[model samples]
Target: MKNLHTRRHLLKTMGSGILACGLSGRSWGQSAESGVYGKRAAEVMAHTHENFWLKKRDLYKGAIDKDDPDFIWGGGVMFSAVVAATRHDPKYKSIMRKYFEGMEVYWDTKVKIPGYEPSPTAGGGNDKYYDDNAWMVIMFLEAYEMSGESRYLKRATEVLEFVMSGWDEVGGGGIWWHEKHTGDSKNTCVNAPAAVGCFRLSKFCEPKEAPKYIADGGKIVKWTTKTLRGGNSLFGDAINVVTGQVNGGQLTYNSAMMLRAYTCLYSLTGEDIYLDEAKKMGVAAKAFTDSKTGQYRDSIKWSHLMVEADLELYRWTKEDYLLKRAKTDCDFHYEAWKKEPAKDLITNGGLARQLWLMADMETAAGRDFWKKSDKLRR
Candidate 1:
């Protein structure tokens, strides 16, 4: 509860105080390591926020067809970051509204899918990406929670059902990554978030209808864990439905998505099974972190989602090391941002989210982890 309030304050101030001015490009020139936990983190968060609002608004501008918010199913990743930014600040309300409207721009209404195609009559994006649609449901659920809009709630439910249509017994019970008979694999990327969608969307449903989503979430989790669980409690990438070929790629986002799903189930059922699994995934995620290097060896595009899970785990377990990783990860990102600008809203918005979360964590635990008023020697 305190974290919620702190974040709300952090975001509100961040929107009005930092984003109000044209604080574009860089917030601080290179400096030595000195920080007041409160101010420095806000400075960094504002810098990241500017990259999206000023440098790369095209990612969610919602005016284009080819690069719409739902482009390639990664738009929702940026959407999640914006949703987090708004969690504690009302100044971002208008920006958040545009994001909701952006989804409508991508919706293929006649085809019952919400994704990018050139036009309403273009009839191309209707190929149906279950994973993309599932990701939409998750974002829509959050939109509903934030705005209390019945349309978002309805959209989420509709998308959830649409995503579930890809589920079949062929791959031992998991949704295919895409629809329209094109996809051949059952993916952890899809199933893990699909489980999360089921659990969260249940919040607005009737009691009779709610538990069913819980069960469905459990089913998705069971299938994914059984199929994708790798050594050290982390998850692998995907499996071919027909050939039974497993692509053993370990990604941070996949592991984080499962961690999120497990946490949702734990919160829903108050069951140790869910909490224990979440904890296992949390501990296993250490494989991606290198404290000595202040770096994580994974897709930078997805690190934002991955560390998002780290923050979530720290919140529940009060684990110091997880928080430390989160702070160190920010240090890693600060260097990364210095070398190259964030190429998309996912990286920019995600960086904003983690910095914001670090601020909230600092407030809640009386810690000064993100002392980013300093410059890295690199």
Candidate 2:
């Protein structure tokens, strides 16, 4: 009776605390105003915070301990999930701002061109991955769009500038995967999202600045297409700078980012070529979907990006099939997650990402997530 009373008291205080924070009961997945996806998103958000977030550090631990803070890459995905949740429940915006402040631990200040390193500053840091920073730029921009926060936009631009520093004549003009040039290869993972970042920046910059970003983004698209594209218009992993050898291993996210890049270009340039290529790539992405399960073939890290791509495509073409495919895959994944949830950093990040994607599906309402929005203002 004592333990049960304690548990009941804990639940009561938690509910009161949520109410004090201006969140509706539905925001806790208790009611259905936001729909099933929104409810699940709220549940996963709570789970992630309860399991991973460290209030003292203001950042997330990789799992349940203080010893292993999550890497910046996974943290960036988690950041994205927080941003997505804010779209539906504006009460989450405060938590998003707190996370933004906490993420500074990964910002590498030792280098001339500072960017986010893999590890935190206290451990003396590690290699600065362009792909990791590129993901940050994308998510930071999302936060900026939703909150209209100048700080988020400024940080996005700064990180993107660091990523741009990775680009050179290497691998015939593409961004290297990491600052150390470990593999000496330019990857679709980095370049594709970098291109998307550039195109996205074009939207927010001054008219004079917009042209440069678009032109630069176009150059990246041109090089990436000519160099790394493989059979059926799908993108391969990476290309060695010295040997000109292509790593033919394909991941869904590579194609997914490239697909978004193409679509963004189409939106900006209104070019039929970019639109045509985007449609082709969207169709090709189906190859990554499982025939039996209808879910994406890869883990949450890779698959959620494709879900983002499909949703973006659906926004443009009004294609029911595109939306349907994304919804089905996410629905299946959500059910699976309920039975056996992920416990680690990256998988938990992936869990948050899919819930984020589901929240996007719920609140999209014809608004383009990539663009700046006044609608998301609290």
My TM-score estimates for the predictions, one after another, are 0.76, 0.86
User: Taking the tens digit of each residue's C-alpha lDDT, what string does model 1 give over 1-378?
Assistant: 453343234323322221121112322211113333234344544554554442233345222213434353546666665665555456666666775665565566565544433322345465666777777788777667666778778878877887887889987788988775564888888898899888777667865566567667767877887788886788888998788899888988899999988777656545466667788888788788775775567755677677778766665566666666777787778667768656665566566666655554535222232221011001
The regions of model 2 sitting more than 4 angstroms off are 1-34, 122-126, 364-378
Output the lDDT of residue 304, model 2: 84
- Local distance difference test, per candidate? 0.64, 0.76
Compared with the true structure, the alpha-carbon lDDT of candidate 1 equals 0.64
Candidate 1 stretches with Cα past 4 Å from truth are 1-72, 112-124, 181-183, 362-378
C-alpha RMSD of each candidate structure in angstroms: 12.0, 14.6
Candidate 2 lDDT score relative to the true structure:
0.76
